[model samples]
Target chain A: MYRYDEFDHAFVSARVEQFKDQVERRLAGELTEEQFRPLRLMNGVYLQLHAYMLRVAIPYGTLSGRQMHKLAHIARRYDRGYGHFTTRQNIQYNWPALSDMPAVLDELASVEMHALQTSGNCIRNVTADHFAGAAADEAADPRPYAEILRQWSSMHPEFSYLPRKFKIAVTGADRDRAAIQVHDIGLHLKKNEAGELGFAVYIGGGQGRTPMVAKKIRDFLPIEDLLTYTTAIVRVYNLNGRRDNKYKARIKILVHETGTEEITRQVETEWQAIKDTDLKMPQQDVDAIDNYFRMPNLPQRPEGWSQLAAARKADASFARWVDQNVTPHKNPDYGVVTISLKPIGGIPGDATDAQMDLVADIAEKFSNDEIRVSHEQNLVLPHVAIADLRIVYDLLLTDGLATANAGLITDIIACPGLDYCALANARSIPVAQRISERFGKPERQADIGELKIKISGCINACGHHHVGHIGILGVEKKGEELYQISLGGSGDEICTIGDITGRGFSSEEIVDAVETIVDRYLLVRTDKEENFLATYRRLGAAPFKDALYNETANAA
Target chain B: MSVKVLTANRLTDGEAVWLGANGDWLDHIDGALVARHAEAVAALEEAGKAAIKSNLVIDVNVIDVEERGTNLYPLRLRERIRQLGPTIRLDLGKQAEKTSANAA
Candidate 1:
């Protein structure tokens, strides 16, 4: 909903012109492939296994109907008729030409979007809750602050060439759909006892080779010092971060090596100088950005929409949808509808161009023409009128986008593994497909309840396997694809790295192994309401680990 | 064969630079000559070498590179680095292109 102002438009246009020139040099033979790789990657372009992959940033996972349609168009025209929505809420095209990138970027800019900061060791896309302003538990909309941060960091004078890439996430709501804990810097907006706005900051959180939950560095930072404090934290890492070894270069490692207390001191020392400077939020600027994120004016509910409920009260299928797919809204009459891109047995986040267009049309007609990209790789219609639920559901149904399992077992997150990615050591998409097929039943998924299953091709954790309630990491053992499972990993405010359950499994048995773990939890757990995460936390991995590796139970 | 109007943005200065006729980058822009933008021209030359070796060269011919629009010196430098194998030391063979041409 944030329209690009003149300044924003000018800035993007300038970037486009510059890239177009670079492309020409590349084609003309002045720029060699080696010379241009980082330059291209900074714009979110990658030469994958078979084709050039271009990742376009869907910042904070929000999009308008027009932008969605444009993406659909790009998919049909340039790519293989679809785009894969990544675990980070970005859309990646697998078949873009090196020559066509500048053109693709120009089109994106027309929609007020670009691939800037999507990759290359810079502060990557600033992700946020899909239900930012509309969620019932939201303290305040985090997007205005996010947008301010975005502009400040875009082509920032310093900190661009850091040791490694950085990721930041913000969530205003009590429930963390943005997965704030796993980000490099996670900010949770909160109103203190005195009703003043502040942020609960988490640092040193990531899901790559080393997975760790962020340590809380600041309990509640005042609103005035948000950017200054964040800049300080980044600056401390930038100046002292390990550049000798690429693997240990992340700020997460720095925090881990030097402890959170020392890191906090360093950040505070850096902040003392810049706190009152231009980084401080100007009233007019904050107000201007905040205006774009303001809630839509909706009238009071036409009484008994909830009572209208389900025509067939016993229709458990419909009830399942209402329970899982729908989220409560700040406004009574409106509900945030999560359209699951993960139809059972379909690729985790790959949406067909037709499906994208259909969703765009639905957003424009039924919802408020606004769509959101959840970090879990699902689509959100944040302002759907409760009265038109059935109509929207029917439309979503035709497109195979109407799966009600939003947080349920079936909404798995998986990366484009060896199938597309050059960095992967083993296959991920196939393993995910295997799991999807195994747990294809909607009723089965609903019974298992809200379980987060994530798979990464390798340790990069693009699939966010580090945060999954049941995490699966695909690795290679003697040239054969194997999976290593981790239990109790979470991505909420209280984040935790999953403990490895035991030895790896062959690809053939991995999916079944995962299902066995879930089924065992279902049988032994106390009640139906207790989710996988809750059960795991109460008892730790003993029960689940024994159930899987103990030869007698394993045979069964 | 191309159908769309494309735009490119530079990551460093966030300024517009012309794609060189030689297939890499150019120091001249608008009415500004390479001599006028001396620092930028030199940086582009360095980047040109890096870009040439960044990935498998594509869309443009690898041979007859000057006509294809890429720098010859960087191509030679990339080969030298490959020979040395991950040793960050710069191969003196790299600067031979500029020196040889200047000497001639």
Candidate 2:
């Protein structure tokens, strides 16, 4: 974890104080709601359906145990005893008083965290693969470059208020766990044939009303030009992006409206103008940032941890949990444990105050004092020793954090739809809850295999429903809530926006529709190993569509 | 004519509050000032403006409601959640508050 220098401390403290003054002015009737809307938004405060939401950034989804503890404290002290982890790797406190925001921000600053770019039109939180440095297939840790980009974009004058929000994601591995394809700018860090570090840059990808997979703008951008090239891309969009309509404002819309070749030409021209300037970081600065993300020292592991194997053999539930929630680490001795936030019949991505505190304790005691928030809305102990897995599992189990369903049917990603969002047309949480309970059986979920079920209340796609293996979008139809299902979507290396299967189903009919589709896939799949996504891709959405709408199947 | 009620989140605490007959904000929806006619809507809006001026609440707006006999119910599902609480957690929000009060 990177420690904040004196400059960082001073800068954050000043911003907190400034926000405090602004909030005071707003509360004292010095500023109207219209005047204060942008000011509050810039500080990550949103006025939702019934209350306010405060979104806190977890840069690259990395946090220390101490920071996690502080987050728990915030949830306990300021919020409604819980926080919702979002798809962008941020945590949103759904209820916070306007007067208390400055104090909350001050507490966050103490942990070297701020909500600054979390909600603004500026470059939002720079995210990377949750298993950034720990994944087995990573070519290089993407966080160093992410951190550099974070530093460069924080309060950058030129790009602060673009046509709309801009997002950037980076991945170190060929397996795109960071969902780089669905970002405004997606950087794939790789070593070229000559062993030189560079990025395969993709631009103008986004998921919203109009979803797009990023186009490859530059095949191999040299490491030195990372900042300069990124600036060029944003500059092109900032100047040319449409301001006439808010819906047509995102960079992805610009790329879609303007031909990719012409946009590439414009970006190249802009890059040529700025490549030699101070935006290009020197070698020493890059090296300094890279050192902060280096793997922590851990003692070498014994060949096989017999105790872990024995525990698995002893307890079938523990074995199921390990199989579902744990991923292989880059270091063979250690394991990355995902703490499922999705409990059956519970709100997805929500961790209670007590659970947060307990997870923080577990991180401190057994997992090298580091924690990560995955984009899938689960928490990760990225460097837990395999030998300590049982105890860590036990601790999480005691607090209801150890749900044995990760990447399974129950690990749902959902936005706070009509439940909390002012913009939502219908409810999402109840639908997700129903789905989780329907597939609550560990054996059943394991049989279903790695299925991604993402739901959103509206077309904003905050839940990344556009990329779900089974995407459910809630829409209002004739004063009733209807769920529109899309299949064959994926946010991976094989990035594709899902195609809508057919007519939407009523809320009552949706869960059954999902189950019907799942059942059809189960019967149609060659083997259980072929997951829902793989089966859908292989056979296409026709079978699944037929299963839902066919009167004969419904009768049966 | 369709009936309506003015609702807003309290500025200080962000609790869901509704305009009352006495020109006050009430936490529970049962005591809300339901306006059956257009004139009553004007009165509720006037009270809402005063509340805003007093910094009592933010984002004040009217929502459609149905008056069944004497009891009132919100028409839109979103407003119902606001009046009650999160559908997922019955034990957590205003619904719990109402339940506990009735139990007592």
Candidate 3:
């Protein structure tokens, strides 16, 4: 929870006023669409299919109760009473009118939030592990560094107009919940042997038409040289990245063309010159940012252990929910509760205005006013006491938020494909919905185990389909929707791009096709203990591909 | 040649609309002015450009359509989804309004 100082408040307010003036000019026909497009995109406003979309950044997916309440208010007032939480840990309003964008931004600025850099060719919202502060296994909270990077990159003159949109992710844990491997720059925060914090830096990773796992450029970059080293890497790409073709514009393409060793050498050379400059972070500045994120004082709640056991014993439903949706917190007395946005047959990552309001209330009362938007498209109550789990669960159940299917087959991640996106070739929501419903049964899903099904509308990979245990990509072919399935992909410590199974399936055949892979996986897996990803890795694509296409091939 | 119609999202609100026979934008594609021949298609394209210049619309295009019975259907799924709201959410877009209108 980084509070905005006077400078931060003034900066955001100034941007809002500037955007308001621009909006007025555009509405008055003083500027053409072409002239206004880039300006609007910089402010996170885009002309989507049915209406304009406003993407608000939730920096490192952190939010306060007041900010969440304000978001709900905006959704109720300016939008259609709901917002879609995207894979990048941002929230997008689908039906905000272009005329109302200025007012909407004004409301956002009131909270310590804005839509700046959510779109455009600037460094996008820097994402980190959702369980940054609360996770049991983290080396250090990554958000402090993320905030530092945010401060450094916000309106930075040199890197603003890169060849393409850039994304950076950080994770303090070895688990890689932030999907750092698929971003333009991935930073793994860790403590070396001497107990001094540093980062293992990976560069040129991206997911789009061409999905690439980032190359580890630096094994241990000192924490003091974070900004200077990052500038060096981005400087190298900015100079050499292709602007000739938009498809070939990302740093991943440049990295592919230039060998990793040469690129690393270039970055190190650049870093040597600038590492001693003002970009070098001082110890006091790092501590200043870290001070903002210090953990809340928690009096030992020893009674919660017995209380939680009693609650679990009383309700089988609650027991199942706790098993699935809750994860271990840094403090033994507390548990991190994931509010499943993916209800059976419901839209993934969508929270209605009422639902958002309810979550705010729950956060304020029980969870110390902290809420997190997971990159997996779920909300997190990061510091709920183990004893208060039942109460939080009950409040969430009232709003249909307590589905208890985290990391299960039904816990899907999807992009707003043809439904809202003008860039989409086919619909992703319906396909996700159908698959969720097919695997809706809890026992069935538990039997299938931890299977991630990520769907993208197009090859942009906004849905992170490239890293799904079972990835479904929808494309347009001969005026009809065709879904191409890719299996064995994962976004973890051992990140790997999925391999396509075979020919694509039509919309009608897609759900069944997914079911075929799951069923095949069930048959091949040694036991229930082995997850879909583990099974897929153990036995390659041959079995799944045979399950998906062999019957059709034989019939033909 | 397949039938065609000029369409765009209104500049102010970004609501999807189509050019009607009366040189006005209609919210629903049912009332859109269809171009059967090359001359009519050219006319529609000109109207689209004029609409953009007038700041009435953005992202103007002439998309293919076919008449099935009295209903107009877009040839491409993208345009079809645009003409009607998202297929997944029946309660959203123009389809919901149309349903309510028919019910009334």
Those runs of model 3 whose alpha carbons end farther than 4 Å from true positions after fitting are A552-556
**Stretches of model 2 off by over 4 angstroms after superposition:** A553-556
Model 1 chain A poorest ten-residue lDDT run: A303-312
Give residue B24's error in model 2 in angstroms: 1.3
Model 3 chain A worst lDDT window (10 residues): A547-556
Cα lDDT for residue A233, candidate 3: 87
lDDT of 1: 0.77
Among residues 3 or more apart in sequence or in different chains, the pairs in candidate 3 whose N, CA or C atoms overlap within 3 Å are none
C-alpha DockQ for predicted model 1: 0.03
**Model 3 — TM-score against the truth?**
0.99
Instruction: Please give, for residues A150-249, the per-residue lDDT of candidate 1 as tens digits.
Output: 8878998797998899889999877787888888899999999999888999998887998778888999998878889999999998998899998899
> Distance from true position, residue A138, model 1, in Å?
1.0
The TM-score obtained by model 1 is: 0.84
Instruction: Give all candidates' CA lDDT scores.
Output: 0.77, 0.90, 0.93
CA shift at A339, candidate 1, in angstroms? 0.6
Q: Candidate 2 lDDT, tens digit per residue, A1-556?
A: 7788898899899999999999999888888777888999999999886678899999999999899999999999998899999988999998888889999999999999999899878999999999988888989999999999998998999999998999999999999999999999999999999988899999989889999999999989999999999999999999999989999999999998898999999999999999999988899999998888889997787644887889999999999999888898988889999999999988988998888889889999887888999999999999988888888898898988889998888999999898889899989999999999999988888889999999999999998899999999999887789999999889999999999998999999989999999999998999978888988889998888888889686688
Task: Please identify model 1 stretches exceeding 4 Å from their true place.
Answer: A303-307, A310-316, A553-556, B1-104
Ranking by TM-score: 3, 2, 1
On TM-score, the leading prediction is 3
